[model samples]
Target chain A: MTKVTFIEHNGTVRNVEVDDGLSLMEAAVNNLVPGIDGDCGGACACATCHVHIDAAWLDKLPPMEAMENSMLEFAGGRNESSRLGCQIKLSPALDGIVVRTPLGQH
Target chain B: MSRCPSASTLEAAPIVSETVIIVGAGQAAGQAVASLRQEGFDGRIVLVGAEPVLPYQRPPLSKAFLAGTLPLERLFLKPPAFYEQARVDTLLGVAVTELDATRRQVRLDDGRELAFDHLLLATGGRARRLDCPGADHPRLHYLRTVADVDGIRAALRPGARLVLIGGGYVGLEIAAVAAKLGLAVTVLEAAPTVLARVTCPAVARFFESVHRQAGVTIRCATTVTGIEGDASLARVVTGDGERIDADLVIAGIGLLPNVKLAQAAGLVCDNGIVVDEECRTSAPGIFSAGDCTQHPNAIYDSRLRLESVHNAIEQGKTAAAAMCGKARPYRQVPWFWSDQYDLKLQTAGLNRGYDQVVMRGSTDSRSFAAFYLRDGRLLAVDAVNRPVEFMVAKALIANRTVIAPERLADELIVAKDLAG
Candidate 1:
């Protein structure tokens, strides 16, 4: 099983099992995590799913596409490792990736 | 041409943080932030916004927010502390003046050059302002933001003579609420009906009769050419030179995407930022969603910009997934809803390209559903206070299946039973 770690803004760590085809965003939503709203239900329209991906795995994920990059530009508390979680799909290769949460959203 | 200063400094910074930076806070912005956290991404996230308040919904600004039924706190997608607990660092009332796409850096109005690996634009849409004579009169108002709603609510002091220019959803919603509060309302529409282009003829007629019955003076096939008054509008002149009494005038022409920033950055822009099914823009490393981006929705069978909360939230999720390299081309049914005059109108799917329509229930009953069929396939369903029918009709649109007219008209069959 693919394993992913989520470090909330308050420093709470949660480990989750992920199917190869499921997205990181889908995994979090399915597990009932609170920080990510995913209001658009994985559409690129809502920026609530912004996440800071672990830098070590940055090269493992594909480069930010035009649409995803444009949206990350609007996320709250943006950072260098900032990425929308829905844009990251779990894979066997990215089995041990970790991400952090931002501080404010509105 | 003069450029916003922060944008220029953006090129110098290198994106090194684990958090994502989202500029322009709005409904789409808020949804993106929430989705990122829910998706198990634990990194420092920053949201820069030009507005001072937290991201709240705008649809209710014209309806419940204006009517005072929706409290300001309820308007919030989440309480302010919720974002704090979520660890979303929001810089409000601060604009991103410059963007260095090459460097993946953003320059804020305060001259902070921050870098971002991923950038999302949830800038949302804005109200198309009027430019007619006396359009700037203090008495004239345009509804789009929270401040605009607050001003209109304050102006709606009992017995105010409110003149609503452009009898579309916004104007009609205000009219309905104002009439109930004992304010004399006049709705001016250029089309013969209040909502001609947006809804079916029957739907438009239904709203017209509802407003008239409520004692709202709705003038169809009329245009306001000029507004006259020193500070506030005192009178409005029509295309035919007819003058009408007015205390406050609200112009509800429509909304356009906040695409100036994106356009300046050399991103492709059609009527909106054109995105494929996954909400990808033409440029590499950039994605546009929400009202600012237009996608060829398989559900609509046409390129369109959806301004509903549901659309924005769903699209935001798809964009996040695409960014995660788990791209599933967004293919979801489109749904929308509106409330006016105690009547709730819900729609699933696009009614365009429909050749035939069958009324499933009685409009006279004040609760019914209209099934729009194209080539014997269900295209859309407009339900008025009929949530049950709306659900099944949504399934019907997704399935593209046909329902017998007899079964549809029979309430005994019920929506759930027809699902079989």
Candidate 2:
């Protein structure tokens, strides 16, 4: 299992150990993390699972697909580090990945 | 702005001795449990569900679950440990046989009685079954629960003849999955076109064409008269006297809201359990959410009973707040989506009572949005692979924004800029 740190907007930090092959959204949701909604069940349909990865870990993740990019265009508070949690799968290379949830989700 | 009480305020408040009994453990029931805890309701939470397993998402049951791409565990909204950690008392595979509103208690099928200070009726709907002859045939199926989808998946073999009784989202989604699995799929719709109840004819035509391109046969204006055949084969007889042979049949006609318990309890019900904006039922201390409640929509100036996941989740949260004395009104534009083949159809707001439709972009490109307007005001939008338009249109509809048809149809005008 890889360790993932979810930093909420209020600065509340939660460290969770997620199994490989599960997406970051699943890790947060399964662990009862508050911010990430994952309303569409990780279909990349809903943008409620928006998150921002640390700049240092940006290149470690997979490139954003066309659908994820288009959907993120309307996500609230999106930026350069913004990515859909459902689109990024966990792997051993990204052992201690950190993602910050936005102040609010769409 | 109405804000929830801070964590410190909730902690400082009196210890809650009240118990909240939530009936019908589905999407709304699951969310209610989470919301109650998140809102710092340190009370007893009992979730009663007829289904044996924990609450799972039903949308994937028709798409990814049927396609064999998403596993069963992934369909669950939350893990088992989360429920335990949340301290939720769950009664799975048990039905609420009686609801005594005056006494503020419910009788379970297992002869157990539970009293509650607050009652949440999240009892959702069931798939509407066919009333014609042989409707209960062993070969016929309806996709509503995990068991239903599992049955269909087990029968989904390559080259199998599959007949769909309705051309709605569920049936069409199954048709897409079955066709992709190399099955001979046929869709029969009773209306003049597919998705007639939900979308306009133009959008329906686009979806129908896409399904046709995928080699799925769609027959509209056709009604099934009966079902016949034995173990080896199943035949569907239509009103046109055509007997369509099928290895199995799936029906996605519609859903009938489960309101028997609410009705028996003497709560007002009109098509669905009648509720106010706060999701409170006719009875005091009793609230209802999800597909079973007919609540008012301030935006539309009408009552609506929505079956979308968005409504279920939002209403569940709203109901929880009301139970906690937060009492915020529930009002939001409804939205729904469908996945067929490689296309994604996202809809925002209701297109009902629309006076005109403005088409943005060319449908031939397979990426366009249809804007529904009434008296030059935005009412709703049906976007096919147009995520930006869908998102902007949702906001525009909520704000009752009025945009000219020419400006809406112009391809040069960016979707976001239309808000100006």
Candidate 3:
């Protein structure tokens, strides 16, 4: 299990143990963590599951693909650290990864 | 602006102990409940659904779930504790039989009455069935509910013959899964081409070729006349005097909005329940959203009834905000997607009135985007396995950008650069 933390728009931090091989979006959704809608169910189609990876852990995670980058362009409040939670898979190597969700994704 | 649910306001109203009752438990209804709580509406929220289970995602019903790649429990949008934690009272296994508009109350099938200060009609829609002889046979089926897919799953045996009535997305998606599962699948479409009503002929032909290459037989302009069989086996008769024996038959014609209850309550319904930009129905203190709503799309500049999860979720949020006294227009750019085999077809914007079609990338390579242009203005785009192009096209369509046809047709130019 990997320990992940999700910070909401209002600075509400939620820490949960996510299983390996599960995406960050699924971890948030299964644990009832608000702000990550995952409307398309991790298909990488809808960008509702937008997130901002903490700067410290950015290099530790895999690079963003072209599809995810394009989808994030439509996401509100997108920045250089912006990444789609659905495209980020959980693993033991990324145990203490921290991410922040945007205020809205439309 | 008249504070009485007018169409011109973008502000939230003051909240009280008002009870907001949402009818229909689907993606839209689920979003409505979530948005209400997210917006800090402490009022009571009662969700009434006909299905026994909580709200689940429907897109997987014909794809992953059918292929046995996804479990039934995973399809649920949220766990059971979600409603309890969110303070949402759910009425499952019972449907609202009657709606008394004046009283702001709905009568349940079990003779229970629930009154509310505001009501949300998200009744969704039902699958259109085959209106032919033997259509009621025990071997025939229509996919809409979990039970329907379960029944079809049991019949999808290896080497078993499966006949799909329509060649729409649902039918094609199911055919892809059925073929992958070792079933001999055949699709019969009444239109001249599969997906004729939704996509351009070029895109339709592309899909047809993809399905044919997968060993699925597709016959266009051929209507299923009748289904002749009992409990054991069946034969699907066609208009051209040909018959194909099958172990199971599924109808994927289309969906019809569940507007009988809304109509009975004297609500204005055209193709669907008519609502304004704020998702307000003709009646005050009442609103409608999701597949059951026909609202004006500002981007399209016309009223359209979209049966997509994006539309449902977006409209549900708009209705919930309006109920909380925050009236914002529902002007979301309509988008939809479908996954068949290894191809992911992503469509952005509505291509209703297109005058020219520009092909970007290589169609032979099966990775391209079809740009619909109306007098040099981007209208819509159908991107197959090309997500970047589809995403850029959405921005172009939303901005109503006009581009030279040569730039769009040039595969050498990057999607972002072309849009820029």
Candidate 4:
């Protein structure tokens, strides 16, 4: 199991274990995570499952696309470290990464 | 302008990070969480939400969910174990009261603190309530949550008097369900037609007959005076001195964005949270998504806030990418859908500024696609029960391709060439 720590927008920390190969947005939906909605069933249509990547690992993340950026125009409170959690796939290499949510989600 | 690449090809090898926070528990939030994982970000994920239940879709809340046709489990995008398998920490029923951008922390109502490098706000919208007398009566209903559906469902007893105050999709949808359930549904609209605001006159006429045929009493140019129910239940009186025997009242005029937090945080807010093409707020480090943001569209060349599942989810994805420091601007053609009785209404792009509207299907058959053209430019389309036309219209809208008005009128235009 891959152990992942979640720091909520309110600074609440929850550590959970998960199998590899799942999406980070999937992890949140499976765990009944609050802020990640994933409305479009992983299609890039809805941005309910938004999260912010910790700046420490900013260089390690993949770049966003035009579609993702275009959709962000509709997302509120975006910052430099903001990344749609659904865009990120879960893997062993992603262990110990942290993301902060906004005050609330879709 | 170069067409945008698919999100799949943009996935880069994610660097290991220590914390990822997602606020709110709506569809956009849920999608972002999954996208981050799917895109290979094995970061620590935490989702903070104020709602007690797990994240669920709200589209059905005013329709199937209220009708009891679909179970609550079906409302979930995934099964219960999906989150557990994904290792996402879900903090439900907690509200984040404050944000310290300087310190990179959030303050919870319970006096707890959560530190983050970045944050996302998917806090969606709420039903706009009326301020008339007896507006808070127990018989009043506003559909926005599962609980709201439950109350409306319970009140929809057979022969129960139903008074719908708005003629919008939510109100019309609820009326269809209620009328089918054997309740007398009366929709009171201040506008001249049921869907006068969003659709063209001809398109509006098609649905006006639909609801009228469904045993629904659609009162146009009507306004509600007040609810005169006892503390628990009663009837609705209109501004015209007409009284409808209403056991319950449902308001579906429109939605008001939950922009308090964003506004308090000093983000630029108009009718909704205003974001640029990159989904960035006037204030850097803050992003807004979903029905809450008003952004400009290249197609319309006007700022608009789309209230549809399509806008919400796509915007959420864009915000995520922007937060990740991989900026891509949001520019998808807007699309929306509404189900009323057996008619499926699908639309792509905006018809607000259009001057010409051509019909592609037979309106006599209660099905057609209304194509909106602005200065001969194919601007948008509202297709009813015409999925093929809708698909083609999406392509046309995306490519900004123009069609001969005569072919559209004659239904001779082929759709295959418009799509990939």
Candidate 5:
């Protein structure tokens, strides 16, 4: 299991232990962490699960694809660190990764 | 004017904590269960589903799942451990035999009785089938559940002949996948144009062309008179006297809202279970949501029964909020989407009572948007391969902003700027 920390817009931080094969969004959702809607069920079709990855763990994650980037553009408050939580797969290398959910996802 | 009481007003009323029972284990029920917990409702959540499996996403069943690009396990909305961890008691593969609204209890098919203080009817719709003779042949299929798609996928082999009985989104999506998998797909539509009921003729023509280019035959204005032959092979007889041989036949006519259970309980049901702005049926303490509900929308000002994942989620969230004494009405604008081949069709708002359609981009490029307007107010938009415009159009429609037809057609003006 990988330990991931999720910070909500209101500064509510939740530390969750997620299986390696699960996505970061899945981890947050499974732990009942609020603010990450995951409306499309991780299909990359909806941008409701947008999150800003911590700079330290940004390089540890895989690069965002064109589809995911396009979907994130629809989300409010997008930035260079902006990523769809569903697109990021959890792994041992990113065990201590931290991410923050944006204020508005729709 | 708000139709339901405000959250603060509802909180001021008397509070009674009791178990919440949600019927039908589909997308709406799944959302209701999660939303109840999110809304801080610590009561027991008993989710009763007629199907044996847990709640799963249905959209991919026709697209990625049918094309073999998505795995079966991924179709699940959440991990199996979610219910156990959330303290949601799931009773699957058991149908609710009767709803004793007076007694606040529900009888299961297996002779089990469950009582609840609040009941949520999220019983979604079923796929409409062909009523003609030989429609029940073994080879004929309908895509609604996991077992249904599994059967269809097994029959969809290379060079197989597939006759889709409808030209709606479901049928067309399957056609796109079947054609890519090297199957000879033929779509039979009773109307003169595909997607005529949902979209304008110009947009329907574009999809018809896309399907034809992908080697799928679309026969519009052709009615299927009957079906013949045995379990091995079938033939579709059209009103035009054309007999088309089919290795497999899948019916995607439309959906019939699963309101039988609700109606039997004396709930007010029109096209579906009649729900108000707060997703409450005529019967108090019982709420409804998802495709099985016909509710009033503040945006359209018309009664509608939407069958989109967006509506299901929003309505489910609204129902949960109301049950928790938050009482937020279901006021979100409706939106829909369809994935056919490489094109992604996204729509916002209803195009009903439209007076004009303005094209924003080149149709030949297959990356354009059509904005529908009634009088001067923006009503709806259909965006294909243009996510930016679709996003902006959603905001514009929500605000009811009116843009000149010329400006909408012009490519120089940024879509986001139009909102300003």
Candidate 6:
């Protein structure tokens, strides 16, 4: 299991150990971290799972796909650090990755 | 008159002693539990479900779960520890046999009675089964629960002949998976075309062609007479006297809302359990949500009985807020999606009463969006392989935005700009 940290908008931090091959959204959702609602169940259809990657670890993640980029365009508070948690699958190389969720997910 | 409680009121006076009993553990029930806790409702929460397992998502059951790409563990709406951590008492594998509105008590099938201050009925719906001869055959199946899909998956052998009744999303999705898995699949639809009730003929044609290209035979305007078979072999008898042999028959005709309990209690049920904007049933202190409800839609100015994850989650939150005395109207725009053979069809708003359809991009490229308009107002949009259009259209529909047909169809204009 790889360790992942989720920082809520209210500054509550939750560290979860997630199995490899699972998306970061699953990691936070499985661990019951608030804010990141993967309502689409990692289908990347709903932008509810939007998250801002910690700037330092942003480059370590894979580039966003076309579908993710399109969906992110309409996500609330889109920014350079913004990515859908469902699109970011956790791997051994990305151990101890950190991300922050928005105030509310639409 | 009871004044609606605001956030301040809830924080100041939390009803910790009251008990909230939510029936039917599905997506809506799961969301209501989370929302109740989030809304500061520290009341006793009891979740009773007829299913043996915890609340799990139903979308993947037709696509990934049936295809073997998604595991059963991932199907759960939350981990096992979530209910425990959230202080939710779950009674699985039991049904609510009776509801006493006057007494505010519910009797479970196991002969246990529980009283509650607020009751939420998220009973959802059941798969509409085919009613005909041999419909009770063991080889026949429906895709509504994990158990239903498990039965279908076992019959999905590589060379097996799979007959699917009803060409709706569920049937087509299963067809896609079975075809990819090397099974011979066929779809029979009683309507003139597949997806006739949900989308336009153009969109339906697109899907029909896609399924045909995937080596699945689609028979439209065909009626099934009965199923005739013995132990080792099964055959589907069509209305025209042609008998088609099949190893397994799966039906996805539609859903029948589980409103018997609510109706028996005299809660004013139409096609579904009737609820007001606050998700309150005719009976005071009783609420209903998800596919089992025919709640009012402020966007369309009509009552809708939707069967989608979006409706389930949003209505669950609305019901929770109302139960906390923070009454808020449930008026979010309805949206739905379907996946088949790398194609994602995302729809927003209701296409009912549409007068014209504006097409964006080209169907030749297999990526396009169809905008439905009534009196020049955007009523809905069907986006196929067009995520950008789907997202923007949802917002535009919610805002009731109006745009010219030419502008909506122009590919040069960015989708986001069209919103303005």
Q: What share of the reference contacts survives in each candidate?
A: 0.14, 0.48, 0.48, 0.31, 0.38, 0.76
Q: Write the per-residue lDDT of candidate 3 for residues B251-299, one digit (tens) a residue.
A: 9999999999999999999999999998999988889989999999888
For residues B60-159, what per-residue lDDT tens digits would candidate 6 score against the true structure?
9999999898889889988888899899999999999999998999999989999998999999999998899999887888999998987777789999
The parts of candidate 4 lying over 4 Å away from their true place are A1-106, B1-13, B417-420
Tens digit of per-residue lDDT, candidate 5, span A1-106: 9999999999989898987878888887777788888877776666778899999999888888876876766678888899999999889999999999877677
Per-prediction TM-score: 0.76, 0.97, 0.94, 0.78, 0.95, 0.97
3 or 5: which has the higher TM-score?
5
Output the lDDT of residue B314, model 4: 78
Higher-DockQ candidate among 1 and 5?
Answer: 5
For all candidates, what are the clash counts? 101, 0, 4, 117, 0, 0
Question: What TM-score should be assigned to candidate 3?
Answer: 0.94
Pick the DockQ winner: 6
**TM-score computed on alpha carbons, candidate 6:** 0.97
lDDT of 3 at B200: 93
After superposition, which runs of candidate 6 have C-alpha atoms over 4 Å from their true positions?
B1-6
Better of 1 and 2 by DockQ: 2
Q: Could you give candidate 4's per-residue lDDT for residues B166-223 as a string of tens digits?
A: 9988888888888889998889999998888789989887887888898988888998
Per-residue lDDT of B1-420 in model 1, one digit per residue for the tens?
A: 011113223234322235577776787787777766655445677888888989887877877788897577656665576687778899999988877777778788899998875678778888888777877788888998898887777778778899998887788888888898899999999998887766778878878888899999988999889888666546888999988877788999888888877787777788888788877777655667788888887765678877777767777777665555445577766777677877877777888888877787777787888888777778888888776677667667777787676777777885666778
Q: Which residue window of length 10 is worst by lDDT in model 4 chain B?
A: B1-10
Q: Please give the lDDT score at residue A41 for candidate 1.
A: 44
The weakest ten consecutive residues by lDDT in model 3 chain A span: A66-75
lDDT tens digits, residue span B49-120, model 2: 999989889999999888989888888888888889989999999999999999999999999999998999
TM-score of chain B of each: 0.92, 0.97, 0.96, 0.93, 0.96, 0.98
Worst 10 residues of 5 chain A by lDDT: A66-75
Docking class of predicted structure 5: medium
Model 2 residue B51 CA deviation (Å) reads 0.6
Taking chain A of model 3 alone, its TM-score versus the true chain A equals: 0.97
